[model samples]
Target: MNNFRFLVDPVFSKRFGIAPFIGPKRFRPPALNINDLPDDLDTILISHNHMDHLDYPSVKQLNKRYGERLTWFCGRGTRQWFLDNHVKNVIELDWWEEYHFSKKEVNIAFCPAQHWSRRTAFDTNKSLWGGFAVWDTTHKFYFAGDTGYTHNISIFRQIGKKYGPFNLSAIPIGVYEPRYMMETQHVSPDEAVQIHIDVQSKKSIGIHWGTWALANEYFMEPPEKLSQAVKNNQLHPSSFIVVKHGEIVDLP
Candidate 1:
């Protein structure tokens, strides 16, 4: 992302949902809390309006710390939520739309993802949901916030053709079990590996796992399955890796 700093889908709360403790419980704590994040972050990217990814407590803390100086980029129909919460620096984008920073050196594009959005009983699909394709003059990156592996397969190939060969990328690789119910919304580790190739990511990391006990899979199952998928595909293990929670990884 060039020299720009960004945070995506930040959640510091231990419980997620409409109420304090009425939702899924976080099994592991974040590597760094809102107070411990790097001081230089000027942007936040939210893929959708899911309570887990768009934690209210974290948003308030971020807005208070950065105010209008920090910009919030989210999917369509999501800006109103931030505005209602007094966050005035928020911007929303539709799928395939690109937003350029004031510097004109950085670009953020919202890409279509096979996922649904809902924060309440009546708001299902009211807001847009998707992944991000971001880049600067020197680096290209993709963040697959949360998506399932579509049988069509070409959707991801389309992403690679449009904006890919990413220097580094982050793709979801967990919360996928009991394929009967989860297959359409979350990708298994094996499918995640295919997405790595379909998106042409040079180096990718597994995310959205080992944090909350939202799915039926074991906490340690994701990385283990992902490792096997990498080998099954004959790709280098480092090409797609799962790091310890709170681990700092360097990107080329």
Candidate 2:
């Protein structure tokens, strides 16, 4: 299986004149600056329509650079947007459709996430939103886009058991605040740990935190709380890691 490397929390363009920021005040976000990446990038799987995940500017840049050389997989609701933008080579899938690409046996499955979607005021949930499960013949990886704790997690666990024992998972662990309001949309650090256990992944990395200021909590809290939760729950430190921007992990 080819090892996948992710460029975490990158901001390609400033939005609404606000410079994109990562984490609290401590970390620096990475910038690739190029419109095109490697030619071997076969597929780009996006979790949802949120600006961060479905970044239009970045996508446009990539599309212009790579054209049909890259295939995009996104949530069902995002089809029209891509069509409007004239993005070909795009596949929009609902919560459980599987798409395969390449001779390497790479398969992608769209999974459900407990979150609402709206790029504008008139279009909430206009597109289905969710996470993703990617597997090659030998290993599986879960990318938990923005989500809250929900029964669907167990569904993913069942899916994992049926087809997995995933080698790695990228689960969200930030943006939860004022539990009353965020609980239904974002998972807390503790809840993230529970997800790690539910999926029974061999190792899980935390993301989506330390990226944007989407909530009221202090920025540094997510990683700190995640660390404590892992200790309180007795999960191995090596099993869960919080990566910085520009960092790369070679999948085992």
Candidate 3:
């Protein structure tokens, strides 16, 4: 937003994991390559340490090309991993922590999410996982990193009350199926709509689906359900939506 560019949970590999070819293969190739990104792109926001969300190869490549010119923001305990990879311009934010890029232009805040992290078998939750609330001169945005609808219901309200009525938000709407097992870790389409409401978002773009075959749900099912949920909730169709890969959303 404004003149700054930031990428969140960027996973551009053919597959989702520490190595591109190891995990769930993607149904579609990444929309663009690292080199295709705008020259002004100077920031990255990593919500957590899951291999899928924090692809090692992509991060390494980005840092190699931009070096210190790019600043990285991620949850606590992840800064060391970036430093170990030779990326020094990295900052770790705790829940509700805000980083002032420029008081007048940009401010990035890390907020809690109902999610867990496990890159390796041994380090489950050793690092933090959450979402981000970003504000530019004229717009506010939220990126709801891999999370489920929490039982408390008050979580989203708190987020909204604190830094919400987001001009735009990115909320996950897939990889949920066999509700018995996924409900605790991922939100169903209806739940996602509830989140949009609770967070007081003006508009939300669906994400975390339509790419890799990570769960058993039919890949196209998310948007279908999202549409129904929007109607059930009496929301404008465009209030929360999905964009095809490579499509751009022009916001006022």
The residue pairs found clashing in candidate 1 are none
TM-score of 1: 0.96
Candidate 2's C-alpha runs over 4 A off are 1-11, 16-27, 151-153
Whole-model lDDT per candidate: 0.89, 0.75, 0.89
Instruction: Please give the lDDT score at residue 101 for candidate 1.
Output: 85
Instruction: List TM-scores for all candidates, in order.
Output: 0.96, 0.88, 0.97
State the TM-score for model 2.
0.88
**Clash pairs, model 2 backbone:** 23-210, 77-127
- Native RMSD of candidate 1 (Å): 1.2
- lDDT for 189 (candidate 2): 92
Worst 10 residues of 1 by lDDT: 149-158
Question: For model 1, what is the alpha-carbon lDDT of residue 178?
Answer: 85
